[model samples]
Target: MTSTLILGGRRSGKSARAQALASTFAEVTLIATATASDGEMAERITRHQADRPAHWHTVESPLYLASALQQADAAGCCLLVDCLTLWQTNLLLAEDETLLARETDALLAILPRLQAEVILVSNEVGWSIVPESALARRFADEVGRLHQRLAAACQRVELVVAGLPLTMKNETGTR
Candidate 1:
């Protein structure tokens, strides 16, 4: 089992990079976290769906990522999570801080136990200017923290910029 974290800003091609990596495996599963609450988000989801290969299995998991990962068959499989930012958004909307902490802990704990190659996509929002609203600031802070923790747990960490991936950490025997 191996875990990798791909971090970049919005439209930084991180998701595309994850897809390319996932394609190398025999079986691929996409854990899409985005929810279509508005027209713009719906269009974005449609575009993402169109971009994915027909053969890859897609699972809509806006919440309960730990359960989803636990249920997935990890052996010889590649699991790609599109972006964690939206997942964080969903958690924040719940207004239960305990749920956020619990979910994040569960996800981090399960990564090491999985047999599949896992690729986690997340937005690097901390590099930008501080957010104006309190909620936005909290979200940015939490996402940044989540990225840090996940990156440490992952075998490889890549930072994508302008469609280019700059490897931060790549363990031995990982192609």
Candidate 2:
């Protein structure tokens, strides 16, 4: 299956780009990695859900992303994973110390074998200044390393900024 990784800063149109790319497919499954832990977050999730096409199937995968992807994959269908950073945050805060590496490894292992077209959205956090807190620093570092590995595994990689997309890597070598 063809796969692409879309990276961008906050509100940089990464999710929009992923949606546009997946629009070509006949069937779409949006695997969301967000949980409404607070009132503000609940509002944000509601807004995001309202923005997406109602016809698209939605799967809530706050932690076990790989398993969700596996269950949702279909031939000729498109699977869009909106934002991995949230997923990272969920893993980071989990009580199970081994959960992070286990889930991440599962995701990487399954990406190459999926039948559906894959479009992944992730925040580009490497550009910002280092965080003061150790947890924040670890989060940044983990996200950066995850992006690198995902980029290498994916067939195409694009960076979005100001609602514009720039292809960073394309195995097809075409514009």
Inter-residue clash pairs, candidate 2: none
What tens digits encode model 1's per-residue C-alpha lDDT throughout 23-52? 889899999999999999999999998998
Error of 2 at 173 (Å): 5.5
In the range 25-57, model 2's lDDT, one tens digit per residue, is: 989999999999999999989988888888999
Model 2's TM-score against the true structure: 0.97
For model 2, state the Cα shift of residue 123 in Å.
Answer: 0.3
User: Top lDDT: which candidate number?
Assistant: 2
- Could you tell me how far off, in angstroms, the CA of residue 114 lies in candidate 2 after the best superposition? 0.3
Per TM-score, the best of the predicted structures is 2
lDDT of 2 at 38: 100
Each candidate's number of clashing pairs is 0, 0
Q: Summing lDDT over every window of 10 consecutive residues in candidate 2, give the lowest-scoring window.
A: 166-175
